[model samples]
Target: MDFRTQTSSLDALSGVNADALVLVLAGDTLPVGLDASVAAAAKDAIKLGDFELKAGKTLVLPRVAGLKAPRLVLACAGKASLKSARSAVQSALSALKSGGTVHAALAFAGFDSLSEALVEQTVLAALEVSYVYRHTKPSAPAAPKLAKLSLLLGKDDAKAAKAGLARGQAIGAGIELAREAANRPPNYATPTFLAEQVKALGKSHGLKVEVLDQKAVEKLGMGSFLAVAKGSTEPLRFIVARYEGAAKTVAPVVLVGKGITFDSGGISLKPGAGMDEMKFDMGGAASVLGTLRAVAELKPKLNLVAIIAACENMPAGNAVKPGDVVTSMSGQTIEILNTDAEGRLILCDALSYAERFKPAVVVDVATLTGACVIALGGVRSGMYASDDELAGALLAAGDAALDPCWRMPLDDEYEEGLKSNFADVANVAGREGGSITAAKFLQRFASKYRWAHLDIAGTAWKSGGAKGGTGRPVGLLTHFLLSQVR
Candidate 1:
């Protein structure tokens, strides 16, 4: 859909006519003067007692003689929240479906410090409907799509609003990319498919793409990552995409994603029930790629590197058994106690490889543990940062993006769970502090850089009814990158 910015006067909206004009007011009342035509139409609706403006109240009314539009949508939802605002926007979009063009006006002055949030969330909410995932079973019936979106100003200037709209659009596009990758079936989105997707993304955005084969990965001694790939017939790929907008001297931020394309727990197989959802085991990898997609579009003056260890973890004779010990690129040996806990194994080597860049920071996103799903649930991703300052920065970015994250402790005591008798560390680290210990395992190889771990097990996707990748942490990760460059 086309999105544009315009000033908040009747003259500005006079030349253009929309199917529906969505006017958002503050609290339970209309503002003193919301565009002359809009105000007159709303006043008529109020007089008829058909629509009383109040908190969370929404109404669709016929446009009066003075208004240029055929219909008017009054959303009395306050600018207090992204969720509520999105609901209001969905209503406006639904109202405008009968017509081609849609116009939206929100009271920016109504929000105090949340002006930017209100603008960004509203735009994001409108764009959220743009991603229509289709299936063989009729394609969710196809919602009527709008041709253009005109954002109207209420009681604030146009500059900041325009900036927020651009930011939201870029982030939204990135989320769309992530969701598509995560939603695809395992057969269609294998390690090879992921490598191809990264190359396509790089070609479109001027990024340098490199795909390392199993032989190449073995040469680098990524034994831990290769253990999982050995069982799958589909070829393994260690994909790296670099965005070098900054100078060579600057240390780039490195993001590592666990891209186990379809994890079947290898030798320690998972339950047969709900195995189809394992397609999203690569959600972490998808998120990093998604974030890069946005970064490419936004073009920040910061160097970024995405390391994706793409492969499938299947149970076969060649699969690493529970007793197997593998040497990582860092020369650390890990005892594979439970093959289900494979994300950390791949990420450990990737983290060790990140040191070559002398990175400013290294963050790994993974669907690491079910323990994290129990701790944080579906709302937030579990975060474990090496330093408090880095954690604080990520938290702020997550908050701004509305993709919230909760920080978990990275105490030295958790390392005890990962102690191995035959190797340097054990992959599972027991069931007690599973999530924390998993982070501790990855931390062993990332001591050279300011590192952070995001366990996106719960937030990456949904189960049951919604059953698709939520396109999470892409928002959080993208916002964090933008914050650093800004």
Candidate 2:
């Protein structure tokens, strides 16, 4: 474990021995106390303008004559907001590619305005940059190892800081899990394979895990979820992992994930171009499992249940046709107007299943629409919620975690396009309000409780050279759960 927490005074910090001592310089704000002294010591460098500490800037200084550490990283924290401060530190950590051990005093001068949440965000962002995702290459490439990352905290806020550090590490581990799963190829990451992995993970983590088979799904009348699975040789898999950290009576927060391990659009085959990227279809399920992984370590005083509807959408003789209609577990008949629009079919069933728990809230994550990627680009997730307070809480959580979401219209007007001549609702609402229509479809099944939908298509994974799962929303989900506990 390279992550550790320590508290040191501004005066004592100068004498401590470590690789790099990170300091933050807020926008146009003069350094004070230890910060001022550190600057004064490096006055020549500051005066000569050897380094700049503008917002989101990073400058590395080595061989300081008087400083105990050989390196000093000055990160610019504009306005000292959590987002800006986190990015500043993130840039510095990324620059230290050959990481050994670094002593970070990121909250050094912002003590009065700095809270534990801010410290936590900084630590997690640092850890995030340091993470190296690998795959089944011929051999593991040698990479820089971050042996240790110690956070320098204020004496008064030491306790909260320690808590934040722990939270950061746990969430980081969870995110790594999500990224790993999403990065795997479709052939290697089948529906049954994912369920088996989740079952094994629960055993290791001491969580209550149950994998429901196709028979179980048939018994529940989940035709909509199963229709998508019929094309692939892989069996349908649904995972329900429960973490009861609070009292038995407490209603748990339910998270439903779309797990179409590989989507070939079934009989509605998509164009061959970029089809390999379908491996990332299960990003939503990976995130749910990732959040549970963190919760297992954090052990907060809140009960939670994570549900994944796992399957594959492939073109085959048995594949469901575009004109077919299937009934969901909720007895709602859905017209399969387009085979490519399958994420919502799986999520709707899981949402209906969540009603069994009488959850306090329900949120389903899915890479449901290409429209989301077009709308939000690669920056933020698209969110839709009927309840204003739930939507607002999620927005606040995203802000705190740096995994932001923009609320799109969940207006009833969009549902009209889903009108089907043959069924209760069409699986898709043409291409107009695609993302919002997808969210609206899932909303019908989750009306039993306060609910939110996260359309993570844009934010889940990057394309091109950095192509891989981003492990989004895990940080957002973890932060939101912790808030509920408080």
- Highest-scoring model, lDDT: 2
- The CA-based lDDT of model 1 is what? 0.82
Name the 10 consecutive residues with the lowest summed lDDT in model 2. 102-111
Clashes of each: 0, 0
For model 2, the superposed segments whose C-alpha errors exceed 4 Å read 35-37, 99-107, 110-114, 138-141
Each model's RMSD to truth, in Å?
2.7, 2.2
lDDT (Cα atoms) of all candidates against the true structure: 0.82, 0.83
Clashing pairs in 2: none
Error of 1 at 474 (Å): 1.4
